[model samples]
Target: MTEHDQQTDGPGQSFESVWDAIEDTPAEAANMRMRSELMIALKARIEARGWTQAEAARVMGVTQPRVSDLVRGKIALFGLDALVGMASAAGLHLEVRVSEAA
Candidate 1:
């Protein structure tokens, strides 16, 4: 891999989820995980439709800055409720599951 393309794992390489990999507290990690997943889904949907960030913002009923944040994966700038609302506005169905932790 090129220098820029190479990733140095550190200890987080052992974990599956980004939240878990960073060793966040359980609640914090779960929150971050959900935000990350929603952002990814939203970005994918926008790309699938060949929409620019401005178009995505219009469709999601959010400002362009908000769409930029979502596109850039600024997880800490969003909460679950906001993400859920955006998903709904985007006509995306979200299925939430709860299970015992491994």
Candidate 2:
């Protein structure tokens, strides 16, 4: 298959969300998805500032190991509230948007 075809799912092969295609329950998948997004946002902020994990820890008020976990995408090791707190400490704004499922 060509690269274009490989990149695009055909017909019913497409998944609405990564969670929908995984083995997790709907709620667990939702939590995982949210954590993943938060991790990406936090990591992006850290990288955008050219900060090391130690610097991120200092800014986010967490230890270096914790910052390492966040940077490494250790979703299971973090909760939504904790990530939100870290994001807040990093001077990032959190916004929740709700819309009907497609």
Q: Per-residue CA lDDT of candidate 2, range 1-102, in tens?
A: 421132324675755466555635767867777788889999999999999999999999999999999898888899999999999999998998888765
Predicted structure 1: lDDT: 0.81
Q: Mind giving the per-residue lDDT tens digits that candidate 1 earns over 4-100?
A: 2324368645445556646458788687778878999999899998989888899889999999999998888999999999988888998989999
- Cα error, candidate 2, residue 52 (Å): 1.3
Off by over 4 Å in 1: 1-14
RMSD of 2: 4.4
Q: Clash pairs of candidate 1?
A: none
Clashing pairs in 2: none
lDDT of 2: 0.83
